[model samples]
Target: MNAPAYENGRLALMLNEPRLPTIGRFWPEFAERSDKEGWQASRLLGALLEHELAERAKRRIERHRTESHLDPTKTLATFDFGMVPMVSKAHVTALATGESWLEKGATILLFGPLRAGKSHLGSAIGHALIDAGYRVLFTRTSELVQKLQAARQSLQLPSALAKLDRFDLIILDDLSYARKDQAETSVLFELIAERYERKSLLITANQPFSGWNDVFPDPGMTVAAIDGLVHHSTIFELYVESYRRRKASDKQSAPATITMEARQL
Candidate 1:
């Protein structure tokens, strides 16, 4: 075969291989650059391999983010840290990196009243973790509880919980919604037990531990669940007025403020 035919054959073979698609797609352009620049063989090979590695990393991060179910709009940049002065921005920023805590399978618990941005903060951390190459899943606590209950009914509870092990962290949004149901709470406790010390959970709840009896109903279960979660956990209590209420107040004053400004003009 001629030189061109031989090169084409190699490219075709690479394209057929599962792992070489990125390299195959970009090799021709890289080869052209190599020829034009009079690059050494090692330089061309290193450049092509580096490009493939970077593209692979990007694709992996995107796939994990999609599977995470994190809200694209709720990110660290969009979170108003000033609103919740108690929750330090620097602390949150460090946690978002998923460095030591994730490796230790520690839990992150956010306690705050409704509309205080607990879910938003949890989701923002999840997004940041995903960008740092950690797998995460964000779901409403009630929804995930329902799914687990169904899995239990179908004799697939273990399987369902096992499937969740793929994620490095699971964010359970609005834990209060699943309160006072024995069946739901049972499965939730089971999940907490299963992942105890083995994986991480990020839970957002409106109620504190003192009020968890309303959620678990069974005191023993409540204590056990709390023990499992809190043993290796970081808790943040956000005592702030509701963001929705603040917005409404601002909105109500806008028209009057506009009128006053018009009078001044």
Candidate 2:
């Protein structure tokens, strides 16, 4: 091959070998613009590196968000703080940063009745943390427990738990659904114990600590699990009426109110 063709081949090989695909794909356009604009070498190199870094960050966040399995519609922006006056918006905003609490591997517990937005709040926090560059996994409590139990039967429980360590936070939605069985609760306890002070957990449950005995079956295991989770935890109790219930009531009343207004007219 000619000198220019050989040089181009070498450049392609170098970019591909290092897996700098973003820079490789965009650098040519950047070079064309730079030459036309009389840009210095350092300025062109800096712009390319910055663009590559930004693209990598964007891709990383998107990949993590997909793996997190968070509800796309539930976010801090969509949550109505007015309905739940007790939950401090400012406090939640701080937690979303994933700095002090997440770094210490703390737990965040959300307790409320059904349809009270516990899952949405937990998921919103998960999404925020993921945006802040933390890995998060959102899963139903029963599903994860069953998975862990199966791994235990296959004697791959340790490996399974180790795989979860990559996530900075794990959001266990609907913790009240995990069966009150020894096998199921045992694995759940093991997971809690494993992540204790090592990785964060965000759990949304219908029942409070007092009712967790219905989930653990064994008193000792219940205490142990609660102990680990509550040690370095931030707990939120949502005391508002069910969001779905309220919305349904509003819809039911709207027609009645309209009918009364029509009669008055």
Candidate 3:
């Protein structure tokens, strides 16, 4: 049946219902379906509200992801577990889901040499957490320190740290890339202290704990930083050959790479 038309062609107003106009405009199809299905008024309202809430939640997640600054290309689906034989697929899978450790504000430390896929693993986990509706931020350690240093100069360091606190997990990529000077390392320590036991952190480094002194000039500071990070952390030492090197080796072994002079015969 057609709705009775009023002077403005909006019979919803005749019921003196303000919410009905919004409902009709936003969910016209659902309104028509409810009418056709002869649904109970209370039930229809509940269903419409639930749908609106779900859509709102989806929008919020998308917005959070965009503000997270995570790399779009890195995801759990794209990470190759086969390439990294030392890593346990079951264990990484559990962590990637971001369910278990996120609640406890635990840290994930990825330590390995260059080209060992440490950054890739950290970004993958950060991406997964974003997909799971958790806020995440990815930034190079040196870059983050520079930003913090600037914030300190401008007398906004506390607010800068506060802004970072909004994220549930912060992926600090290439922690070893930062210089081990007093000016740089102090801000880094401040960040760790602020986030200690409060928010989760995922750090990727080409150096192990023993080599952290190379990243923190003071030995005492190095010990303190390592102590804070490892207290409730899941550490992964990816002791494997470089994936890029292995791929290059495989290409060299392939028949397709035969010399042109040999083919000329």
Q: Best-fitting candidate, measured by TM-score?
A: 1
The true-structure Cα RMSD of candidate 3 reads: 5.2
Off-target runs (Cα >4 Å) in candidate 3 are 1-26, 244-265
Candidate 1 — what's its lDDT?
0.91
- The sequence of per-residue lDDT tens digits that candidate 2 reaches over residues 174-207 is 9988865887799999999999998999999999
Best-performing candidate as measured by lDDT: 2
Ranking by TM-score: 1, 2, 3
So what's the TM-score on candidate 3?
0.83
Residues 31-86, model 1: lDDT tens digits? 89998999999998898789889998999999999999999999989888878889
* Better by lDDT, candidate 2 or 1: 2
In model 1, state the lDDT of residue 71.
90
As a whole number from 0 to 100, the lDDT of residue 149 in candidate 2 is 90
lDDT of 3 by residue, 1-265 (tens): 9975445345546433644434444556766788899988788888767776777677778897788777776676766777788788889878878887988888999988898888778888877777688899889999999999999999999999999988999989899888757877899989998899889999999888887887889888889999999998998888788966876677787765566657987
TM-score of every candidate relative to the true structure: 0.90, 0.89, 0.83
Instruction: Report how far residue 13 has shifted in candidate 3, in Å.
Output: 11
Candidate 1 wrongly placed segments (more than 4 Å): 1-5, 247-265
